[model samples]
Target chain A: MKNFGGHVLFLDRADINTDEIIPAKYLTEIAREALQPYLLESLTLDGFDPKRDIPGKQVVISRANFGCGSSREHAPWALEVNGIRLVIAESFARIFRQNMFNCGLLVVELPCDTIARLFTDYARGETFATADVARGVIQIRTGTKAEEISFRLSDFDRQLVEAGGWLEYADARY
Target chain B: MGQTVAEKIFETHVVDRPAEDVWVIRLDAVLCHEITTPTAILDLMRLGKDRVFDPSRIKAVIDHVTPAKDSNTATQGKVLREWARRHHITDFFDIGRNGVCHALFPEKGFIRPGYAVIMGDSHTCTDGAFGAFTPGVGTTDLAVGILKGVCAFRRPQTMKITLTGELPQGVFAKDVILSVIGRIGVDGATNRIVEFDGPVVQRMNMEARMTLCNMTVEAGGTCGICYADAITADYLWEHIRGEYPDKAAAAADFRKWWPDPDAVYEKTIVHDVSGLEPVTTFGQKPDNVRPVREMEGTPIDQVFIGSCTNGRMDDLRSAARVLAGRKVHPHVRGIVCPATTKIFSEALEEGLIRVFTDAGFCVTNPTCGPCLGMSTGVLAEGEVCASTSNRNFNDRMGRGGRVHLMSPATAAASAIAGHITNSELYKA
Candidate 1:
């Protein structure tokens, strides 16, 4: 089984695109690790600086349509190399969601109302989330308050997660 | 239950049913380009598994930054070239024959109705214009498809978008798609296959259908399909003539892939576009669209008239019609790139290249350079451009550069006026 728990970074914006996640200019680079320093470098969110905000963050909490542009896997690879493995959003673009699972990362989709409430309650303070895949619940808490949110994963996605990605899964099956 | 077109395609291609909704599908084609395929090749090499399942089913190209901008890009192209040669992939298009993968593959008649196709580029859905079940995949899935000829997918729901009326004058397929994206938000069709039909689609040519389907990703759609009809058969006549007795027979055979009349759709949207005007994007998102009249006179520093979205022969002719007796503005720089070498030659033979050159526009070889900020026309900081390509995300064409998406005609008119202007003014 796999689990995700860490300092939550709240990006309160909708339609964060692949170009903003990892710009198209750096796509020529051959290795995934080379994409680390450029993650979210083109993002124009108000009051969000990638240099300052990306450090010490292990999870991302964002608005709807996270990763909406290009189908480049560099976006998720950038996040993985930076040691951030979990993303919580109201919704996600189709290709981005599949890429995350193919790389053994987890993206949790919540209702729009629940995402709005989470932002209302935790956007101002230092918040943390522990995703317990076995328990089917995510515990979001600040220093003084706490809430438990439930999410579901499909059987195939769970299999991909347990196998540590598609390559390993194909190794056993194919 | 009646199946949608996507469901029928999935049913036909299913190799295994791994889970309730997950189907391991056998892919009929795999498209590769320089930017994404090199990573997959490296990964396969690292794992001691560097072989393709079927060389004939693979189509490779060096399109993203052709004739490479730097040593890094050149090495990426080298890796793909070596891999293709080693695998005996004869369909690989090198520098001289290269074009945008989506436009090139369809023009060659490599896609067919009900066939399953996948690529590492988002616009792979452009092939859905031929009624193929095409979706963009990451490197992992792409590598698997290249090796084992299969990938997995969840059963997709269908969203029926019935386009009702004929497009108004000066409004092309680009405007129709932009208007659809504007009505539905960016995420409106997430996890769904958009099936576009009704009178308007039935009359559109293959190039126009491709323009509509190419931007399906912008609305978060997995694929956008048009039922194969006489138009599709006509486009594929040269390639399919040997297999069929006549064009009508081939079209009749392709009609079997259409969705049943009582097909179940997750949602249905209707749009009457007869009164629709030319539209453009105001913000960075593709869905941040408005009518051209709303954002008129927005000064632009550059104009680009080519990409997978609107870089076909019809797109070039439309722009040439507008620029026939005009000149590019003194302050605005203009660039025109045909989508393929074949398109370039066709435009040259049609005297369209002369119209562009005589109007002070710089026409270059077919490349996807300026569309993605890779090369050829990178903008300076704080500069704005009127573009005919898809995706206006922040810094898409350059750092701190703004891109307003429009049709080629509008882009040509904007180039002449040095600002965002509607193409209707130049129409005779």
Candidate 2:
């Protein structure tokens, strides 16, 4: 399993549904590559352009229920295509979490305090973090400051995400 | 130890492992819609697997954005049709043949009791109305099911919701669920199986029961299941088998399981609904539900009545009763979508379509258009819509539009009043 880390794009909302991740308008496009520019398309209202903002970050940090509403795999596809490899949120909608695992996007569920701290640190201009899939720990780094938070993952989910996704995990098994 | 219905289904299908430890279980049925199947087929092609493990067990329908809203979706639909045809998937339903995937699956007798059903749509939990263990999956999971006839699962804890007392005349199943969601909050039942029990659930007709299970996902539940009883048998016999007839014998055997009285539950909640009022959502979450009377006078620019949530016969009939002789308000643009072709035909036969059309409402064919902001009655910027469909997320019906989620009766009432209001106050 490859460890990945990058700058974080912080979304403060509690329930960022799939529709907001990739609006239904983009769903007509069948290819994952075609879904690239629409990741968090609705966030444009908050002045975050999918093309401009997504490329600047490879890890997304959000509050609870980070992927609620609709079982659209396009949500993860859009994020993955936009170069988002790791998502750290307080929680996630069930199917969205499943889709993330299936499509090779790593999701870590942290405590609300941990997520709040991430937001606080990011707001204070500290926006870089690294996720060590091998260690089950996320190293939070800012200039001259360092912190770490561990997350819980079941054996099944850890194995799937570690293997690069459900498809890879399944193929390896069967 | 007594196990819930979901536990039993899991126990029955656990693949080559102990029931409690089983991570993979064989699926009795798998369903997909046009929106998800295109990608699923792509995965299948990538896997170099041409045939589904069990074609008959796989049901694919083109209901979401059906009649193809645009050229892109139309092309995708054509591709799905061609793929289903090539695979000889027997239960595939075309645009005119099906309405919404959730509604049509159970209506076609594809979801029977004791089945472990999976669909590539979140509302697949709707089949839990028949005591089935259903969890909505994504495209890859659907592909997995197609190839292996099984998918991985984590055993979920159970939440038992016991409903006592009868619904008042003006109240409906939509109200019942909305009230529950309002109490529990949106993620209250996250990753849990919610088992509905007690008198109210037992007395609810199949369509009403389906409505309860339909919104289970709104509460973040994996499934909302009701025990199968004579009512379930009667509904399948009367509504499904009576139409198909070849499935009459099969329907007889559909009523196979229920949770035991002593089944262990992680949480047990009791709700008495004898005085429950019609409910509607005021904000972006399904759990943001409020009584219709409380939100009355909130102006609405559009009203939508239909979806897997409440587009069934009873829901439309209730809406029709409210709009029987009334005209829709000039400020409101209303659309009523029957959930299935069968329901559309039946409503047309019963003259419900005439009522909607006479009231200045556009009654379209059975499709899930606009319910998720795909196509059809999308709301323009700053427009407020009263919708019967589930989910009131921001821009859910369209970008920058606000949605008030309500029962069909409330949506119909709002259409007539030009604002979100209660059906009981509307004059015939």
Candidate 3:
């Protein structure tokens, strides 16, 4: 498994729906590649595309009980299509977080200080490193402060990460 | 373990055996419309199932792309009719019987609270208003549900949203949900059981509750649920009591499932919904809440009150109450499409038809006649109309028309004033 880590784009808040991630109307007409145009399009008028986001693994920090809404797989599909390696939120919606992990999307939950470092990273481009999974703590190093962010991964997700995506894991599971 | 009303239901409907290891709650009811049914029927055929598991549990309605917009629609409608007949599915809503599935399901009493419901279309979650645990399913799940009566998945965390205080006058349920979306952002309700309670939630009617719960997914809630109460009992009794000879027996089955006071929730959010104004979603999403009273000179060309979201007798009655004596503005097109033929007949009987026609508004036969972009009442380019439908996606109702969603009362008053206004406009 690739133990990846990076800076965070902190959205430390709640209630991100599938429509906001990818509008329903588009589901009928557009292909998955076109989903990049939206991503968080509704979040902002000139929204950032979910695809072609930051290169390589990146951390997205969010606030309490995140990812709640319809069980649309498109949200995580868009996130994974982009380079979002791991999502560190206070919590994740049941279906959304699972959908992400099922599709080999990684999610990590962290405490407030580790979350605060995410804000710092977004502000100052300070990089965070995730090395050891046995220790749930993620190491975030800024110019002034280096703090540890705690995260936990289920066995299923750890297996997905180890096998590198579900298709590979399914090769073994089946 | 303390469980919210939603959690209790999920636990009951757990997929597979009664063992706790089952993650996804198996769905009880499966709903389908024209757009998604075509693929589902094909998949059903591929599975070599000549007959459905249970006709009563599965329903097919032709709301989307119905009314035969073009040559393709004619073919599509015919195909759908033949498919339904071949499958021996009794519940069929032709264009004449057509209305958005969400609106008619509850109006007709198919969507009961605490039941696990799934629909092919996204707005299937709209039924959460009746305290029912409904969510949208995809093509594969639709077919699977028809054959096996269940779909699998992991359990979701439960979040309790306790709304206190009364809504500020003119502030409808639509506004409350929008404000919630605004407060928590889109992913706030994600992967969690959303149980709405507190004084304000209890005060909402079935229509209002539907409006609130319908958008549970919009707030990122897994499936929205309201505690089944007297309101739910009254609605069921009034609508389906006659059909169920043993009314008490039918009602008894639902009571045991509702979440008790000691229910567990990941988080409890309290919103003081005292002074919020009625909101209109001018843009694509339902969270686009703007007070109709202050449209700020945004001229509206039409007002629509229908669809799965807010097209019911209560919605029509509320709108009619606002427009009883007031005439619709000459510049605006006031259109009302009841969610079902039953609602249409009832409204016509109750003098709502007179109110609409006299006020220069029009009421059409039940169908997904307008919303979903397959409407005879297509809006002109750049024209804006306040709607009561579930979604306001691009060209959702018509080509180049800008749609804003709101409560039916807001649509009615706005229609009378030629702009977005509330019932208060009439008194003023």
Candidates arranged by lDDT, highest first: 1, 2, 3
Grade the docking of candidate 2: medium
lDDT of 3 by residue, A1-174 (tens): 655567655553454555556544444322345455556544422334444434453666676555544445557656655555677766665556655655555777766675665665654554565535656667767676676756676665666666665434433332
What fraction of the correct interface contacts does each predicted structure contain? Answer: 0.83, 0.55, 0.15
RMSD of each predicted structure? 1.1, 2.5, 6.1
Best by DockQ: 1
Using all chains and alpha carbons, the TM-scores for the candidates as numbered come to 0.98, 0.95, 0.73
Clashing pairs in 1: none
Candidate 1, residues B85-199: lDDT per residue as tens digits? 9999999999989898888999888999989999999889889999989998889889998989998888889999999987889999999999999999889888889999999
How much is the lDDT of residue B147 in candidate 1?
89
Report DockQ per prediction, comma-separated. Answer: 0.84, 0.56, 0.14
lDDT of each: 0.92, 0.84, 0.67
Model 1: DockQ against the native?
0.84
Candidate ranking under TM-score, highest first, comes to 1, 2, 3
Which pairs of residues clash in candidate 2, taking residues 3 or more apart in a chain or in different chains? none
Report the Cα lDDT for candidate 3: 0.67
What is candidate 2's CA lDDT for residue B58?
Answer: 84
Q: After superposition, how far is residue A157 of candidate 2 from its true place, in Å?
A: 1.3
Best by TM-score: 1
